[model samples]
Target: MSNQQPPRRFTPMSQFATDYPVLLIDSDAPLRELHNCVSERLNAALKYLHLMACTSLPDYAENDINTVTNIARILVQDVSDVFRVIEPRGFETLKSQ
Candidate 1:
């Protein structure tokens, strides 16, 4: 008898269209959720950065300028935090398959 293993099957989302298009719809829900969450966080960061930029006026005192610079730095750290939270592990799974 042959010792070969059976071929593995990959299920594409389109296959759920018959009686369960809902599965396809539900499958996209996680992506949409992540998109919305990330967009909101990034927009908040941008708003904070915009406030800092606006405050960095030519006539600003040294302390005020320093504060604005610190805010910009904090926003950069916040963006990095968001990326760490949302980064996916699916690429490794695809490679293994």
Candidate 2:
């Protein structure tokens, strides 16, 4: 007998559908607006939470609101930009179409 491996047969699984349609939705403008709104809200909430938490500390100062707000805004912007850049496929698709 010849030493040869049997040919592999390719078969499609019944449970899986190969040609399922992909529905691409366009909502970039709304999504960006929502993201901006949520980000601003979250940053404001965080600033308030930080200020509240700081109030409980011994060295808390009421004059630090500007500094805290500035820092929080910077952090929020950086995080927002990072998120936008990393997952920009949706935005790109929206722009292209």
Candidate 3:
């Protein structure tokens, strides 16, 4: 049988699009790998957030602003990608197994 599945989806605020499209997490991947990916993306998102926090000044050049915006778009895309696999339901369902 074919193994393909439909894309998972997310909504972002009206201000951004990814610099490159972010692919959905592969649910069939090893759980350990998924945890690694979640950690990576969350760390990257945190980095972008920290950088954005520094961009609020009145004298920065346009490229600095664009750099933050572009990465923010990518961060949004990546976080959206990661959250798809974070098991929104509590682990009680797993304990039952």
Best by TM-score: 3
Worst 10 residues of 3 by lDDT: 7-16
Lowest lDDT 10-residue stretch of candidate 1: 8-17
Q: Backbone collision count in every prediction?
A: 0, 0, 0
Better by TM-score, candidate 3 or 1: 3
- Residue 61 lDDT in model 1? 88
Ranking by TM-score: 3, 1, 2
Root-mean-square deviation of every model: 14.4, 16.5, 6.4
lDDT digits (tens) for residues 9-95 of candidate 3? 342322334665344456556567767876786788788788768766577788878877787677666665555555642253587
**Candidate 3 off by > 4 Å:** 1-24, 86-95
Model 2: how far residue 39 lies from native, Å? 14
lDDT of 2 by residue, 1-97 (tens): 9989853222122222246523222223455764665477567858766766667554656667666666666556545543543356466768999
lDDT score of model 2?
0.53
Compared with the true structure, what per-residue lDDT tens digits does model 1 show for residues 4-56?
Answer: 98532221233222765222222223545645655775787788777766763
Q: Estimate TM-scores for all models.
A: 0.43, 0.33, 0.55
Order candidates by lDDT, high to low.
Answer: 3, 2, 1
Reference-based lDDT, each prediction:
0.52, 0.53, 0.62
Q: Relative to the unseen true structure, what is the C-alpha lDDT of residue 94 in candidate 1, on a scale of 0 to 100?
A: 71
Q: Which stretches of candidate 2 lie over 4 Å from their true place?
A: 1-63, 90-97
